[model samples]
Target: MTTRTLTPETSNTFTSTIGGYTVRGRAHSLSAWFVLSLRLMMGWAFAYSGLTKLLAAEPFSAGGYLTHVAAANGNPLAGTFAWMGSTPWFVEFANVAVLWGELFIGLGLLVGAFVRLAAFFGAFMMLMFYFGNWSIEHGVINGDFAYMLVFLAVAAFGAGRILGLDTYIENYEVGGRTLVERYPALEYVLG
Candidate 1:
């Protein structure tokens, strides 16, 4: 996660062009191929999950899933799940959020559009899933933990800069000032 000035002789650097405006930046140790692979893997996993759920019976219903959580024996969060299930509005909202959130995050990651932002939200959603799905019957650490870590890694490493649209957007200039230069705080999400 080092930022070095783009030099003509810089190795491992990438050049991006949009609307005849070309910009160059150092891709650093993160190889474009590697990031693309991770993007596809993580993106497909999420997208597939959402698609299957959408195609499944009662795609928008959280009742069955929440009821299962509530009925699961020895689940510490059973009461909370039951309460959530009792409220139709909350369950409906959660159902829609989960459905669209997964779809958007997956597409964003795959296309390398708004990658850092997507990873941030992806990590947040994963955290929620981890907590909500926690069960005594299953081990404490699960795939959600691994997925969350991957999302965080993608965000921290600026994986989108290698092979994604972010590479161009990151260096996009308006009035001779790039977004990152204009707003230093945007470095976190823009990267």
Candidate 2:
């Protein structure tokens, strides 16, 4: 990644009010590099996790984890998780969804295609994990929560536009109009 020297024109300054408090922040042009780094890092991490599970000698199964691990430890969603685990069809669906969902989300982020969609789903998975792990010893906040926030930030910042395929895809001519222009709803999924 290349870092660009920050100039007055390149710097982004903004102000917002939340909960009756005024907030102000400035982002250096180099912030794009950091966002891109985050995208790549998360993409690699998720991809590696899914790939390892796929390659494992034993078939991936969430039944035991959901029924025992997730239901235990005072989890607020214990009943729901246990029910899902006990349901044979739901367990089967979860196994496939978890394995393939991670792989697809990772690939989408890595290639910067449909980044918003990927980040949305990634955040959702992390949210599920945050509740599933259910560790409050240190605090309610944990790695899963942090990762969920990062995923949200990635989508909010439109990180895929930073030297990503989304830029080209967004501009590709479709029936004489750019894809984004042709289908406005695509903005929700693409960068």
Candidate 3:
């Protein structure tokens, strides 16, 4: 996949507020809209996936997979999937893993509640998606993965001043230092 560079910070799109920030401070423009758009898109994407999976578990489940499906598609993960098939129960677990992850990602982004946590999980989930497509020659991937990552980074920076709960969540004694805040790339979620 081609790499895309982030635009340098400019304009008032990305803004922030201080003093437990209930929209109490100023922020940037492009950055703020970027966050808003990211949150909305990420939420919808996962909501669509989660809803589909909820509607049909069979196709996504291992047993429903055609034998050598990945190999048929020329993906190297075929071997990994074969190995995983050894545990009869694993497919169910995998399905559950993706379902819950997408569900929460959708919920968090849509509601703007615990958005950082949601973005963290959303980014992590996309990493898994990235790995999934890595084995193919000239592989294809979701066009939105990078956008999701940016949304995550913005949440890392906290966009609650305009429409997020992160604003109020940043001030508690433990709030700024919470686990989500301490994650190396995610501290801004608490800021």
* Model 2 C-alpha lDDT per residue in residues 1-191, reported as the tens digit of each score: 37779668646876779899998788887999999999988888888888888999999998898898776789999998999889999999989989988988898899998999999999999998998899999999999999999999999888889878899989999889999989989899988
As a whole number from 0 to 100, the lDDT of residue 180 in candidate 2 is: 91
C-alpha lDDT of residue 21 in model 3: 70
Of candidate 3, the 10-residue stretch with the lowest lDDT total is 62-71
What is the TM-score of candidate 2? Answer: 0.90
Please, what are the lDDT tens digits per residue for candidate 1 over residues 109-147? Answer: 887878888899899988766766775455677887778
Residue ranges of candidate 1 with Cα displaced over 4 Å: 1-32, 55-57, 70-73, 136-139
Runs of candidate 2 with Cα error greater than 4 angstroms are: 1-11, 14-24
lDDT, candidate 2, equals: 0.90
lDDT values, one for every candidate: 0.78, 0.90, 0.62
**Per-residue lDDT of model 3, residues 21-139, tens digit only:** 74533355566687677677788888788878878846566434423444455655767755555566777677677777787777667766677777777787776555444443444
lDDT of 3: 0.62
Error of 1 at 154 (Å): 1.3
Look at candidate 3 and tell me the lDDT of residue 1: 31
Could you give the C-alpha RMSD of every candidate to the true structure, in order shown?
8.6, 4.5, 10.2
Q: Against the true structure, whose lDDT is highest?
A: 2
True-structure lDDT of candidate 1? 0.78
